[model samples]
Target chain A: MSWLTRAGAAAAVKRNRRAPLLILLLAAVFALAVPRPAPDHVPFGEQQNVETANPLLCVHTLLENEVQEAKIKRSLVLARELGATTIVQFFPWAYHEPSKGRFNWERADRILGHANRQGLQVIARLGLVPAWARPSGPDQPSTLNYLPAESFEDFARYAAAFARRYAEAVKALIIWNEPNLSFEWGYRQVDPAAYARLLRVSYEQVKAANPDMQVLAGALAPTLERRGSAAGLNELEYLSAMYRQGAGDVFDALAIHTYGFRDPPAAEPNRERLNFRRAELLREVMIAHGDGDKPAFITEFGWNDHPRWTSAVRPSQRSAYTIRAYDYAKSNWDWLESLCLWALRYPADLLSYPDNFTLVSADFSKKPIYFALQDYSRQRARSEALWLPPPLDG
Target chain B: MAAAAAGWLKRPIALGLAMLALGAIVAAALVAIIRHAAPPDVRTAFPAGEIVVGVDGSFPPFALDDGETLQGLDIDLARAIARDIDLPARFLNIGYYALHDALISGRVDLLISALRVDPARMDDLRYTASYFDNGFVLITDADDSDANFDALKEARIAYEYASSAESQIRDWEEDGRQLMRRPYELPQYALDALRLEQADAAIVDATTFRLYQSAHMDWSAKSEFISHDPYAIALRIDRVDAWKLVDSALAALKESGELAKIIDRWL
Candidate 1:
């Protein structure tokens, strides 16, 4: 009776072990026989065939404090979250040299230093048009045109010095911003010929300071048509006019500023000229000038989400439109080299005026449009141009 | 509570019968609530009279504080709707986000804050026919000169949380691209970043940028628009009647040429 009971218990243990083994074998067979279905394929609007570069999304930062410092960093962190890689900024001429010949690259150095440490590639535009550069008169805002021809050389010197000092950190130098636009040329007058000279001289100096560094031509503001005021010349006309005025071979890449409005980019009847298609027009002009082979970049282009402002679209619409426009721009990789949006955020008090221009609110609230960008940035890969053929359409 | 109790410890054979009874009771209660909430012809019953609609006055063309008064496209449109409904209209101003809270809390009967119909919001709000379209744009300092998207990888950008701009930015990042720069907010605090030179650029709407430019024409900072936006009126999601009433009112206003006049008055 004892042997029988022991044998029964032993058999029970053996059966328990066999049950587990059988279950394992069954599970393995089931896994092999029925694989999970592949994920559903939703077609992306368009696939990029050209190589795209990854650039950073940047915003202007005002020195306030550690909090402000953290605030700006948070903004950058958000941009990084959206896949921005480079920053385009400025070194204010007025702040750097309030007094003649005395320079304060300390502030500039700190800003640039932090950006570099954060792995941000900076493209500094060296044109604040200091008061010293202007002629003696009532104190007025300094613009690109205000700088005398002599001052252009001085600017070049300063630029050269800055580049030399930060050669390892700073990679690109844009001579000035929107020199073709009257506002940038100085509100007083529009002078392409003079501006060209400034470019020629400044480019030479900047290049001399850093041979390996790439210097971009100043961005040309997009305009409706050729007119009488300072911004009278459309982007293509202004660039061509500058080239006609002998602005050839001054810088490396041609920079442009493009914005699309309610109007279609294509021209129509009755409208003598249309600006909705300013970016395309500028590209056409680049080809006409035989500089079609040159790579083009759009420093700023975007729509507003302001509900109250006259020039703004409803905030809801702004989100939808931004996503579509960005996707379109990204899809058309052949026509664009690099496109940096106008901004990331603005001041709160200025929110009433600058309120609508941000992807997020001044207090760091996430807007619907910002989420759309985050989504796009997450899915998109920057296609690089290993070998791009010269402009064939041109 | 009764229905939940019936669901527990039930015999498999009786489970189906108990579930049916619970469903019938819940349905009966829901029907009773629905009937008591609003009248079927709520719009008609509220005799055409002057109705004051409260709005977040920050939005410009839609609603804004004109220094001393609240006036905007929506204000005028509301007036026109009132007139058609045989009533007068008064404007009450508030903040953008607060407008929604006000409406749901019965502080206001309607909300016109460029509301969009999103799935997540389907439960809390109902929208009328979208009257306008808007798009997001990229904002940068007027002086930025980069030519490619790749150039913006490391820059700082700022946006409001839960805003459309924030979503757009998130979508852009989801493509596995990384920016060296980040996003932030505030120009005055960061003006030093822009002026003394701390930050690179900012992203914002064209109108707000222009408003800032117009105010600070002398400040030397400027913004440009890069993108479109669409808009609609919103009501309490559960108030399907209110939604239909508002939608019909808007349509009637449009047909009577009253909408055009109102739009002209503000926009």
Candidate 2:
């Protein structure tokens, strides 16, 4: 070697020998400072050879002269294509039990009957009080919105009876759409304690009728604002109060409704604060009640076509959000078992109108949301194994 | 010779120890200075420990308040923001309008009240990214023929005070000037003004208007969100540091795909 290079090598060896302790200490610190991989989660639910992972899809029945069995079959097929193993169908009380005691299960029979045959699950939402249920007034107006305030018990009994008979075909029941809402509760005023009582009664009766039946409490519409005459409670406070009033143990799953403005699932620009991590909130309440591990069902959630629903997503956006939501729910398999869109099709009168919350047109033409679901279903069908993301922490 | 070499290594170890001690002292001093310099940006701007975020708990199929608890797009979004930053979110009973002041003077850190950021309230406060947006809609008793804006011009327009709808109406009035006659605020003093039929039509948010229209026979609706403004997280303009922190947190949220997940929970 050259004399200069040999001298340099000797100097480096001397420098290292002089600070051997320092070098060892630095190495120890570095070892401790390195990050470790996050822990993995255990999967839940029916992870067997299922074709679709998503368990909920939006389906609607347009007001018609006659209920079409063909349309029902198409919807089932559509739901199957949309990666949904479950379909949320509205059972408006006005149409079903038009009069007290007397029943007309014709529409439900067709819908639920068909859904059962297709091996798809059905979530039966029971609401829309009939004229006979309303309290008599001096200016006797026969509006279906009002229930015989006293007949709430009778209604529960009827509801339980309905659950008993259809327990085999349809077990999931979402009571009274958005009862926390003033308009949904007949727009006169809201009483949480009263609603809790109703929930307890219905829950008990349904459970008594069929213990195997899954009873999802009514999906509370989101309206934390208590402005003007349109007063409503925040979901957390409402649930807290419900639990306080002993409404916690009434149902199998907590049903929630979620929707965002025109932004995509990734970019919820305007209503970021309003967007709720659906399963997490319910889980929190459940934990508070010492039932943290209970599953949550998103009974009604979808983007609105309302070009101006203050924070509603656009038509294109609706599809993106829907897909992302499905993907997220699938990824986070536990806690969330179902997420039903608000609607499948708009009634003819509301078509082309704002706040258009539908997957299909009045004439049954599919929207982007329909196609998005279909694509997801196809993907799920192709995959041999399924993996979902870990549960979200708010 | 061995003794001399050992001494040399010992000297280097001593020197390294001294440098580390000096570095620790400098770090402590720097931390003290930073703590004193910033002093927690939200001390007065927003309530320090805990604050309430008012939301339309249930405007679902958009926002759903279970009468006591709040969950939905606005509710989930607020919770996520709260978690990222250091705020314990306790939703309050204060309605949509009451929360604005709460945000202004520390009663609350921010109003996740699903408020639309428009030109009218440019002076009130600062707004974060538009989380959600829907068009303005006119909801009326179904029999009422004045569903569209033109037909509803003659009908009395109803809207919440200080709401986005109020601001939009004001903007319209300003543009139209005297030619467009002003619509009455209705009921004189807000006792179920719309319910009392003081206004033939109410200009409400799309989700709400549609929900009412769908659920009630007395309601018919029409909406056009062509100029749909997005809902933004409202914060006081004076709290620059807190605002920056919130913005950064939100940016992180977007990057992590957490924001998208939040939207999925609600929408």
Candidate 3:
């Protein structure tokens, strides 16, 4: 009786351990044998193309935060229908590569696919470091924008991966956005030298992956901040600082953000005043630095029309000034490649003065400026270049 | 008989004192609920000995810097909250994009700008109860009692050509409702059309409609809210003590009717 009871207990214990192992084996085999289906989360409708009269009509779009693929497609359609031939979009590194060596390109694929289908030239802006790449600081946890020196290689690898995958649809890549801003640099002292190193690492990697990829850098914020100020150094001074840090060698083109705030398009450029023609002063900095041969892309620029914002203009004035700003860009700036507006639409209304910067509302309703830009885009011929030849300083 | 009379008197007097004590406790609790006591740790929340508010002073009637002075409904509201907290108020006129960042980085104590209560920002921020609803308002002539959003099957509607009102009307159209739309170049023009009987009803944001009405005091129109976009104050998630002070001050302002008076003075 004792022998039989002891034997049965041992057998039951052994069986309990073997049961989990058996189930795991079966699950592993099942996962391997059955091939997972490709992602078709959103229907890829008919292949479409755009027909636009103005090649310089470009708009920066914020579609990375879009929750629905239908909305992403609809936004790209709106941009193309508005006669914008190009769009600059942000593809956050934290969103795509959340961890080391692992990638989820579903969101990226849908956006690029829809955008390419719509026949729009896409310029990709990459930043927002992944959590694993950001080590906790001494005082507190690091923010998403905090990328350590050790993780620069990891971010470059991710950029190379992006470059290789979307090389067909994307021709240009912006290394970071508003790097001169202390907030964008993770609340630390904004260092152009550190940013130059980041641009170097990313440029080498992405160029190795796709040699033809245009490496753009420095979408500086148009602030009036001075040295030792916390907000950020102004863009004009920031550019000179960047050139001082040997940033000119690593990039193909420069990306600038010039906004018209309480100023007209024809306002004279100064070192202090932030205005639309401020791009001219920035170009002067480039020419002064001997990089005048390189083309520059105005990735983000526009006027706000909110009645209350001190930086805003009237709605009618906003519309007229935006169109005239585009015209001014075409007529004046010779090194300019594309003149993109600040945004097409945000996924949701910011419900502040920033809402007035968009050409379309969150509900997909068009603004009066959309019609203005559309008419302006149509009046010009399709074969026209962005700028007149021989580099006009005026 | 004298002893019995004394016992009866004692019972009633004891019961009367007990009732009075209970009434005092209830009154104190109510006062505690509405008029917040400054936290003992208030110094930790505001070591600067003052309340600093970050406002995007671009929009007028809310908060606008008129070159010589900063004045608006939000400016006065911030002042009243600081007065209730027994602290002097300081304001930083931040830009629209940098408002929340200023609050998070400890540069400002609270944000009193016309910021909507965004659920997305609830992770790092705690919002107080909304003070203003700048939602859309439907404007109809005072005599036109029958016109409203739901009943507008065949009425003529006018709104600013490309404003948020246009989006609402487009949504209504998508739901299979038919109405003749008269898009005006300005919100005031739409109101003018309603005044002239050129349109059956007009739509504009509450703030715009109020500002327009304040200018044209003689015009009478029936107004009803069709949407709600509430504006509230935001504080950092870690600043619970400071948040309580501001929330209680806002509630007191609401109760004392000073908040409405401030809004009326601006509108």
Best by TM-score: 3
List, residue by residue over A1-394, the lDDT tens digit for candidate 3: 3655888988988988999999999999999999998654777677777777678889999999999888999999999999998999999999999889999998899899999888999999999888789876424555667777888899999999999999898979999889888778766678888888999999999999999999999998888889888767888888888899888999999999999998999999888888988888888899999999999999999998876567788777888899888778778887888999988999999876688899999998888788878877777433532211221122
lDDT of 2: 0.61
* Candidate 3 structure quality by residue, lDDT tens digits, B28-146: 99988765553535676677999999987777878898767888999999999999989999998877777776776667899998888999999989999999999999998887667
DockQ of each: 0.07, 0.01, 0.13
Error of 2 at A256 (Å): 0.7
| CA shift of B90, model 1, Å | 34
| Model 2 vs. true fold: TM | 0.49
Between candidates 1 and 3, the one scoring higher on lDDT is: 3
lDDT of 2 by residue, B153-214 (tens): 54566654333455566666776632222233221212123445555556665555544444
The numbered model that scores best in lDDT is 3
Cα-based lDDT at residue A154, candidate 1:
78
Taking chain A of candidate 3, what TM-score results? 0.85
| CA displacement after TM-score superposition, residue A210 of candidate 3 (Å) | 3.1
Question: Model 1, which residues run further than 4 Å from truth?
Answer: A1-67, A139-145, A263-277, A380-394, B1-267
Give model 1's docking category: incorrect
